[model samples]
Target chain A: MKGRKINPKRFEIGQLKIILLILPLVIFMGMPIIFIINHAFKPMEELFAFPPTFFVKNATLENFSKLIKFSDSSGIPLSRYLFNSLVVTVITVGLALLLTTMSAFALAKIKFKGRNALTHINQIAIMFVSTAVLIPRYLVICKLGLIDNLLAHILPLVAMPVALFLVKQFVEQVPDSLLEAAYMDGATDLDIYLKVIMPMIRPAVATAAILVFQQVWTNMETSSYFFSDDSMKTLTFYMNTLVNVNNTVAGQGMAAAASLIMFLPNLILFIILQNKVMNTMANSGIK
Target chain B: MAETTKMSRKDKKALKERMKHLKSGKLERRYARMGYIFMIPWFIGAAVFLAYPLGSSFWYALNNIRITPLGRIFSFVGQGNFTQILIQDPDFMIYLVDYLTSTIISTPIIVVFALIIAMMLNMKIKGKGFFRLIFFLPVIIVSGPILGMLTAEGAGSISAIDTQSLTSAISSVLPDIIAKPISDVFNNMITTLWYSGVQILIFLSGLQKIDKSMYEAAKIDGGSAWECFWKITLPNLKSMILLNTIYTIVFISNNSENPIIVLIEESMFSGTKEKGYGYASAMAWLYSVVVLILVGLFALLLATRKDQYEKQVKRAIKARKKEARNKKKIERRNRRNAKKIERQRAAGKITTHTTDRSDY
Candidate 1:
């Protein structure tokens, strides 16, 4: 083992091995997407066919077209729903990132007596299910007069301790010497943080941002409690209506179409930022 | 040492003073102060947002408090909600069984799958980055809203359309061999996309940190490729496996993922004036206990296996040492025999040292 170097001879074999390695990942990754797309496109007859259709075509955009035009008689507007989702998601992501970064910076660089206790408490909070906290959160929301408001969804989500945990882990990797150097150069504590710390921990922040956004956007539990109006519902609530409320052939088709559409933005986001997001997650101790 | 001993007391005292001054530097004190200032946000957030809510929820779970649509609170019944869930609810058992079964099956599969996929992603290959992107995409998009929209009826119907029928008719015009599995495969694919993201990330990171030397050493010792993976790779992944298991159990067991539980609660509480929140909380607590048990069991397995692994490494080291000793003795014997042959040649006598070094 000590005498080994890069083997040019085994390169071909390694490449082949890599192909073999990737095939299942492709299946695992590709299959679900392909299924969802197919489900979205297929007629009911094909969806429940004894032998399923992977490539049944005459694929039309009618389902998607009809889905986009869908508006209930209750005036439960999809656009309003999308807007609410965006608002709540933005608040959740923005607050979560801000709070997490500050706390993480403190935990990593600041020498404090209770630092370890706080860090460990944050870790335990990671395992504390939002479900476990749901009832109390509901009570709190009502008490705060936030019930039925979008803030009800955003505020509790920003409390997510995992974001703090991730940010702190990332900030820990930024050498203390860097902060000292900044201070030596006559930078204030706030300036050092804004200029040096923020730049260094950018990757962690991006990873945390994506994670926070996804969690808030896709969240149903918190939203379900806070928002009752169908018009006030997020896209997920709208999708749920197709499956549980409508439950017809046309409804299922629309549901499938909406599911695909729901995936489109995040899918696009993932595709665009995946390299950075994954690499940052890897660096930020997500693994 | 003499130089240090000969150092002037004045010089030593000055150095000590400098060290003490360094310890209480203004910069250090300010940094410490800044740290507290920075931590205030998270500290405040956690106390108000997390701890307070958690403690309050526990209290709410113990009491029967109802909130009207208009945000009005009804009278509280002490311990009634907990008792109802513990003793009176039928859906409690059903949810428990559903949750437990799903958990038992999904946890292992997700962890193992994540491990395998991570290993694959870690390998050197063409389009490795591309594949990673694909694997992670499912996780990104399969949000509840997105999935809900995809499954929505009028919003995004999944029913068979006239065009689908036409395509099927056209596809039936083709051979059965290609069409059958493709269709079935496509229909079920999207449903499984939601859970693969975390698994892939876990596995990829686990694969990244495995030492390359392990494979090199195994190969040099005439070990097969498969042997290298089993001996070196699997044991190293134990902690990762534990993490993914716990994550999977928690994610799957959560009522949010399985909406059917809520529907059942609705059914059980349909005719009654009760909200069944107490019953649901009780069930949640029980399920959380099961999760804790699962986590504990996995930890135990990891601990025992780690011990076994350490022992095995020790034995391997010992065997290698013994083999090295034997090889050294054989080499020494060969050297002595060669010396004797050289002397015999000098004396013009026949030599018996005919062994080939190549054969040895």
Candidate 2:
């Protein structure tokens, strides 16, 4: 070992390098996020101003007020869309997470014949072309008299390939000893899944939940197809109606405001559960 | 406890009977059977919701799908729709070109930027978690129709800004007159909107597995930070980069809500469905093929890079040892020269004149 001491400046330089590195992230990610907030608060006229206002000198609740007071063709309230999105997304994510976790736990942990076959099946399912299934899915929904119902969206998304893949990756991390101990306690598979496995994989569950919710929330294909009435439209269909059909500045502004508003639920969820989701993905690489 | 014990005995009897019915090694088989049971709901859903329609679409693509007052029906045209796309369509070529160009440029940028951000995040820094969360916020925010709304509203202003910045950077070394028009059109057409969401998440997770000690070792051996990045970080990220690139190309090419697709949908809504579905399907299939090829190429590149990397590493190790040996030899020569001077002084053979000669 050479008789050389570490330079204090090197540590400072490292810190400086970090700050420099983060500067771009802050500029790119942080600025747009701030713009969304600023745009939300600004009055209509200011938003349309030639040189965009980064900050609102005069803020108003007019956009939110207009959104609430307005009604679409079906006379269903805007709250209905919000309520519908929440209900559909919650159900989809919930059932998907539950079924995926159970299957993943069983596949990853239990020594069983045909596990490899099932895993291969899951892999093949990942490459499924949804467009090919779109017409049939619609027909099935129609035949079942579930067309225009929220279950049409919820049920289809519940068998998500990505969620299953993610949960399988996560469940791989669970120590065999833990599952063995639970088995030794004479816990049934159902009891083990609900009580033991569920708690241990909370972070992975959160990631899967976030991802599922985001997918269901943004899903325009199945959800749009179901909503024959404008009133029954999800937020995505509602926003699209403003641009393609309505074609008015006021409508577009309202759509923009509405889109911004719809983002809040997911954004807030992400912010709150972000640490858990990221930590899970970082440590487990599944999320 | 005694009363429950009697009930438990009854339950155990039932369990034993059920196990016997399942049979010998069939218990383990039953566990897998149970696993498949869990998978059953999704499997059925996938069949009903995914497989059936996809199979039908293949049939539909080869036929004429008409939504008449009677109902929806498909008239089999054999290879008619495919021929129309390949030979009869006017704008088909332009559509393919546009799709391919965007795929080639946008997918790589998104993947590469995600990689860089991931690497930077991997570095031990304060507020690292906060940075990651913020970066991933775009995933939640950039919904399909919301993105449409943003696109319609801004008319690609963000893209324009990025394009202009890039063009100017390129133009700084170019001739002025030649640069202006080229720059303007690029500023108008080519924009670098941050391709958001899952791509970012994939990159972030990919960064996590790289060990930190590699960087520490490089630093100890007098590698500059940039050199360490080139030697250590970039090579380790190959698999993630490949994975992300594949994800991006596939996602972008297959993206239904892209601007051009939206335009096509708008036209169809305007009551001109003549050959629309067939056309869209053709474009989609082509896009899929291009993406598959691109991903395949990237995978090949990644596989080959490993062997190349090992060779480079071996060469570097040899070079480092050679440098160390050279330094040791120089040190020994300096020690021998010092001894020679000391001997000259001991023999009194070196006077002030002799000392001046040594200095010379």
Which candidate achieves the best lDDT against the true structure? 1
**Global Cα lDDT for candidate 2:** 0.64
TM-score, structure 1 vs. true = 0.66
- Report lDDT (CA) for all predictions: 0.64, 0.64
Residue B127 of model 1, lDDT score: 66
Q: List candidate 1 stretches off by more than 4 Å.
A: A1-13, A43-52, A72-77, A167-206, A228-232, A278-287, B1-32, B66-109, B140-194, B202-245, B258-275, B293-360
Q: Write the per-residue lDDT of candidate 2 for residues A116-190, one digit (tens) a residue.
A: 877765554454444534555778888889877778878778877667766676567566777777789898888
- Kindly give the stretch of ten consecutive residues in candidate 1 chain A with the minimal lDDT sum: A1-10
Model 1, residue B275: distance off in Å is 7.0
For B1-360, candidate 2 gives per-residue lDDT tens digits of 675466777787887779887755856767767777766776677667655665565666676676668986566787776677667767766666665665665666677677777667656566666676677775555534444434455533444257757777868978875565455445423123345456566555444434456778889999998897687767765655665665566556445655445544443333445564544444444444554566667667666666576899999999999999999999999999999988998898876453556767
A273 Cα displacement, candidate 1 (Å): 1.7
Clashing pairs in 2: A132-B53, A132-B54, A133-B53, A133-B54
Per-residue lDDT tens digits for candidate 1, residues B1-360, read: 787678899988887888986766686677678878988877876887778876665555555544457863544676776576658766666666555555555556567667777777666556666677677776654545445534442222123434456448746876764454344333433344346576566545455445566788889999997887787887666555655665565555443546544543453244345654544454455555555676567657655665566789999999999999999999999999999888988897975566888997
- Residue B193 CA displacement from its true place in model 1, Å: 9.4
> Which whole-number lDDT from 0 to 100 does residue A133 have in model 2?
49
lDDT of 2 at A236: 64
